[model samples]
Target: MNELDLIQQLREGDEHAFKTLVESYQDLVYNTALGIVQNAEDAEDISQEVFIKVYRSVHTFKGESKISTWLYRITVSTALDLLRSRKSKKRFSFLQRLFGDNNEPLQEVPDFNHPGVALDQKENAARLFKAINQLPENQKVAFTLHKLEDLSYQEISEVMKVSVSAVESLMHRAKQNLKKILEKDNEE
Candidate 1:
């Protein structure tokens, strides 16, 4: 079905349309979340949450932008929310640990390497992603959309609600920042 037809069906509460939506966009949503949150399990959870959000809130989506843009916004927002929640929990846990016997076991941080990387390249990929994570929010989103999602400047502009030139500037800055971060990592 065309996007228009799918959207209309979705607004009409068609079950098939919802299923098609999930099937068509799950990878996009999942990868975007993974790029942001840098965790596979959390990305999977965020992907499901994004769809549930779309299923609940599709009616609020005005047709001013493409469905994918809307999905991108939702995926980014949900992933960032998870990150913020995790950060707050971590901070609170640090405080809680100071005064009592903590029973929670600390797990090793999972390698956040891309799935397609070979074993030898996993370290490089993980290091690259860690630097990407350190970017300012706009630069990180633009870089992820362009590099990870293979989106053009026009597509990223639409998703980010920014001008194409702004996206260009963000991409340039992200590359420069990543270079510096990786260089520092190498030194350390």
Candidate 2:
């Protein structure tokens, strides 16, 4: 069935349609989350949350954009929410420590190794991801969608709610930033 038909079935509360939708887009959602959050477990959790939001809000979805574009927006929003929550928790924990109630230690996120990357490229990919994590949010999203997800500039523009030219500019700046970050790391 076409995406429109699947969406119509989903709106009609067809369980099988929902299942098929999840099956088809699970990897896309998960990988997008992983790229942002840099953790497999968090990515998996965010993927589930993305579907939950989709199921709950599908009826409100207008057909202005493609389903995949909608999914990308959801995944990016969920992942960023998680990241913001994590930052808030870290600050809270730091305050608790300052007040002498420290019971929890700050946890560091480890380097992410995307499973789809070739074994020979895993080490380089890990370093690249580390650099990506340091990018400002817009550049990070644009770079991840383009480089990791292999999305076109136009598709990313739609997902990001920006013009195609804006996406192109973001990609260019992201590349330059990544190069500088990697170079500095190498020099050290």
Candidate 3:
């Protein structure tokens, strides 16, 4: 089905349309979330939440952009929210560590298995992602969307609500940042 037809079906509460939408976009959603959060379980939860939000708010879609654009916005926002919540938890954990009563260790993310990467490249991809996690949020998002999600500057501009030039700058900075991070890791 075409984009508008599928969107109209979704808005009209067609179960088949919803199913098609989910099946069509789930990998995009899951990969985007996984790239940011770097956890399989969290990415799965975020994918479910994204679909649920789409189901609940389909009527509000203004159709100014494509449905994929809408999905990108929602997925990015949801994934960033999860990261913010994790930051908050890490802060609390820091506080707990600062105090005398030590309950548990700070959460450590295991090496991510990037679905898009070749088996031989998994280690390098994991290192890249580890460095990526340390980047500032905007840089990280821009990089992930461009490199991992394979989005163009124009598409990223649309999803991020920024100008195409801004996306370019972000990509430049992200690349520079990643270079520094990888170099540092290699030196160690």
Please tell me which predicted candidate would have the highest TM-score against the true structure: 3
TM-score, cand. 3 vs. native: 0.96
Model 2 residue runs over 4 Å out of place are 103-105
Per-residue lDDT, model 3, residue 77, is 94
For residues 125-183, what per-residue lDDT tens digits would candidate 3 score against the true structure?
Answer: 99999999999999999999988889999999999999999999998999999999999
Better of 1 and 2 by lDDT: 2
Q: Estimate each model's TM-score.
A: 0.89, 0.94, 0.96
Tell me the tens digit of each residue's lDDT in model 1 across 1-188. 99889988999999999999999999999999989998888899999999999989888888788889999999988987888798788777766776565657555566688885689988888888889888998899999988889999999998888899999999999999999999998899
Clashing pairs in 1: none
Q: Which candidate is the best by lDDT?
A: 2
Off by over 4 Å in 3: none
Candidate 2 local lDDT, 32-72, one digit each (tens): 99999999999999999999999999999987888999999
Off by over 4 Å in 1: 97-108, 118-120
TM-score of candidate 1 relative to the true fold: 0.89
Total clashing pairs for each candidate: 0, 0, 0
